[model samples]
Target: MADVKLDIRPVGAALGAEIRGVDLNHLRDDEFAAIEQAFADHLVVFFPEQDLTPDGHREFAARFGELEVINGLKKLDDQHPEIVVLDDAVTPAADVWHTDVTYRESPPITAILHMVECPPVGGDTMWINLYQAYETLSPPMKEMLEGCTAVHVNRYGAGNHEHPVVRVHPVTGRKSLYVNRIFASHIRQLSRPESRVLLEFLYRWCEQSRFSVRYRWSPGGVGMWDNRCTLHSVVNDWSGSRIIQRITVLGDKPTGLGEPRWPKFEPNANGASDFYDKNYPF
Candidate 1:
């Protein structure tokens, strides 16, 4: 295995580790274990210089968990209908910094994105390490988020869906800061104005520069990241087209999906929750 030399390296502060040994085209079980361990230590892994068809990418990602069916995206291939194909030629949504489809009650566990087409210059993907993002916060801020929950959504304004601010990972059982700029409208169960004040403050910190890492892409490159604990953005400055085939592993409901402070609301309830309505004044 040492002869294979899994040239592991960190790409971004968001905890991306690049792997240079195993080929996804023909992965062995033990080699796969090495990659998974690298993922545990690094949270993200990229395999470069291996040629993969859409089937190859899906096959590799399925080894991790059940494949996710993207609600409104085209399938990569008939045989592998669960894959999501993301390319640079997409609409503006693809460029946004998001933890893929957090609008759902239960989001995906991880995501594997393979860069098939890359730009000549200027086009990189950025990710933020939520685990580190939470650890580095001031004690007061940490306290505020610990007992609080924020709504995440894709509907319009914030979180797009309602969920807690600090959630325990189902796989690792470790708590991570869950809010992101893509959604995270505000903290429900609090007065509208107070919620806004706190939510904005938290969002700013989560978006801080120190928590992120950027990865420049090349063809035949694959990056698999823990979606539950990281937020990623594909830079869209290139004039030319860049295409990437992405696969997601669906996850379960967040550990603290519906707490008294973080009540669950209808999928598209304009930010009002049952707990807030029945208990809070504003």
Candidate 2:
């Protein structure tokens, strides 16, 4: 919570908002701080009725931090090397319920997705709050997760990358449950059966309807999310074409600055963690 606030219309007790009085094409520094604070507070900020160009999208993303280069997509212009092009024209295989790239040792902290094209009917994105998902766990469950971490990897299908089952946001200082369905292979150092049971249970808890938000797109929509502690997916049920311009803000290790009551999180030193045989498809 900060001194000044912005217009936030929560989608649920955990997520959702429609911020007003700001334009991506021209935003002041203090105004940008307020928007960032609101994003940190709400986990998901929505700005509708915007028709941003590829250049506009890049400019807006740079205001936050460095940009990320994604593996797929073809529409991205060579001028903006960091922008990720997402659309039906790129790859035939669709992206399932998963977070962006968690393969790197320290993954990108946030992603700004701006809707440039949308289906006339459906094409919504869903965001789940891992913080609230962790908080809602029974006291016994919370205690059980203490000091626990898992591996998520990049795979041919949906990769299994290793990340902490529970992680704390470095900048915002909030704890989040980090295991995602796409990359969560097996908990490191655990037996097969044990890892299976535990991961299955945690996935169910995080995907529950209560701690999430779903946004239906209308061309000019943009969503900025803290990927450190949040899980999100784009809806592909639209049966038609939907395009979005995306840029990710590179982040340090989730446990970089350290915390009072949590275990230290580190996978590799080169900002890319050591890869293993989790063998997931991206």
Candidate 3:
């Protein structure tokens, strides 16, 4: 395939770009480099109107890093475990804002999504830049947060995982607010009441419209985001059916600023139940 100069267009002031003139099915080494750079610069990139087979999707995701085969998801084919199918009829749309798989010790660094079908209107997705979320906080707030850790719990058997309240990006050396409304249960350093209050404030602060970008999906379009420094949620107002396939690239354990204010996290036999007692606001 001949090399075509990538036509990159910024979608929002905070964090998204749409790249035209490149085919995901056949990306050259240099073209892939440009795409990677765009991802790093913008935190999320979208490629519109490209036909990609399951194998091609997996191959493109693998170019970024090692692929993670996720369980408990509907698969496109039993032979292709790496690519999972998401049918809105079967799985309800995710209405809450969240980072992908933060309940794991090593969450995915990047998420690549391929749109198979979508509603004509109202099923857009939005992403927030956590880097901006962290940077905009007052100095005292940053000081208090630098040494904190938070526990994230999944209702499922995946159990609990603890991460820094403020995580430093492995590649960019940038700090980002890592807690979210969905999985993040509480701050490890504070009391239950204090954690709730603080988490609620951070949640509202991080999701301000100034730091987000909303994308409308189209069939055969592809969207990928840096999960390390962003939170995403889907708008649930659409009717009809929506279908997509996803592949994730494995990431390293998150590192935070300075030392943790508390000891390492270890769950007892009671599991996440301890965190889900009557006091849990949700």
**Top lDDT: which candidate number?**
3
Candidate order by TM-score, highest to lowest? 3, 2, 1
| lDDT of each residue in 106-196, candidate 3, tens digit only | 9999989999998888899999999999999999999888889998998776778989999999888999999998889988777666788
Best candidate, TM-score-wise?
A: 3
Query: Which run of 10 residues does model 2 get worst, by summed lDDT?
Result: 256-265
TM-score per candidate, chains pooled: 0.83, 0.84, 0.91
Reference-based lDDT, each prediction: 0.73, 0.72, 0.88
Ranking of predictions according to lDDT: 3, 1, 2
Model 2 Cα displacement at 126 (Å)?
0.8
Q: What does candidate 1's lDDT look like per residue over 1-282, in tens digits? A: 323346788876557888886778788887887787788778777888888877778789888888877666767778777766776566453565667667778788888887878888868888877888788888987776776766666665323456778877776666778877766666765555577677677667766778888888888788878888888877767778777777888787776534554453342366654553443322
Worst 10 residues of 1 by lDDT: 273-282
Q: What are the root-mean-square deviations of the candidates from the true structure over C-alphas?
A: 5.2, 6.3, 4.7
